[model samples]
Target: MTSARRWASVAAMLFALLLAATVIPDGQVFACTPTRVWDGDGPIWCREGMHVRLAGIAAREMDGSCRPGQPCPEASALAARDALVNLLGGAQGRTSTGHILVDGPTMRCLSTGNARGNRTGAWCAAPSFGDLSCAMIRTGTVLRWDRYAHGRCRSR
Candidate 1:
């Protein structure tokens, strides 16, 4: 191969390696300091760059709609979102994209091998809230998704 071609190939390989390094494997346990929240059942942006969707629960979408078969809670979208932000230590501010910056404590999350778009489905535990999934359910802001919950909510 020409010198230029060799350099391009090496660069491509390095880029692939970098992407793989950021991919969290199924069932991996990771810690994330949540910096922003999209809604109650999150796509919470972490300081580490991992986006987490709270596993075992469903909340109203930001547009105030719940996808057909998901547990549609009685709570409004803003209600649910605000409740989650409060649980995370309250909203620090809002981003240009409309996500609320949160002052939540660092949380240890267990990935459940599920993905929704780019976010990982995780069961996370915050210091103030032992289990976020259960806490959301208890607040009536979200509902337990039994398929993903796997009886964890029952015990809690």
Candidate 2:
């Protein structure tokens, strides 16, 4: 890693630690049980084992790296994912553990359009987690996929 990025990472970690002290307590549950599964970054992965380029939906690469020109640091990315896990009460949803309803799409909103139905992709939601995409946005852990999802990335 470049010295700049290394420093950035260290700084980000410190910030995340601070945030954890204030925002993330130690009692969060993490029993996500996705019916299917996706990877951990740049897009939403459904339990069905499909990758969806959902607009405004994203997760940081599990490597915990940083994005070019993005202010969020590398540690922040990982921290965001961790935060989402806490929100979801697990890695997926806490359906088996009894924290999520698991009956509908995750909380999604766009300033200019409807979800456009099955073309966008799929996500799971529980009451506590709300929507994963929104959670990523809230935590700044994932990339802003609107540029990719809204354009030509076909659902795969």
Candidate 3:
């Protein structure tokens, strides 16, 4: 072939090689190991195989009793705690004071009175989930039953 044709062919081959390199997945580059744990209020970037804990609050009373047009008198703030335990496949236990222990995450109940009682709070943490970013743990996931006894099932 001519010199110009040969150079064109070489350029095409180089371009194809570059494209392949960009498209192909590099196992070494993609492979990720477990992340370390840090203290404080934040998220944790964890590996798939690593274990973690999410701390939060649990509702003290969750009775299914209410009247029409009223909220439930008892609310359980155990959404995130429950979800984390389910995801990690860990057992849940409780302390003598009724504190829930799901792996490393501890869920404590703040109040246990009527619907208008003080709202409960919880703190959830996963050491091996993601960085201490806002996206890691959501507020609603660690929610409080604020509108207790305010919905349609309040009287009951």
The candidate scoring highest on TM-score is 1
Model 2 residue 82 lDDT?
55
lDDT of 1 at 4: 100
**After superposition, candidate 2 runs with Cα above 4 Å error:** 1-54, 66-75, 91-126, 148-156
lDDT by residue for model 3 over 50-134, one digit each (tens)? Answer: 1222122222222323335433323333443344334333435555643344343321112112122111111222354332112
> For candidate 3, what is the TM-score?
0.24
Cα error, residue 144 of model 1, in Å, equals 0.6
Better of 1 and 2 by TM-score: 1
Tell me the deviation in Å of residue 133 in model 3. Answer: 7.2
Worst 10 residues of 1 by lDDT: 16-25
> Arrange candidates by TM-score, highest first: which order?
1, 2, 3
Give all candidates' CA lDDT scores: 0.86, 0.42, 0.29
lDDT of 3: 0.29
Candidate 2 per-residue lDDT, tens place, 1-156, comes to 999999999999997655323211122222223332233332233333222333444554455554564333344544654555455444545434333222223433222222332222433345655655555555655555655344423334
Q: Which stretches of candidate 3 lie over 4 Å from their true place?
A: 1-76, 84-89, 105-127, 132-140, 143-156
lDDT of 2 at 129: 56
TM-scores, one per candidate: 0.84, 0.37, 0.24
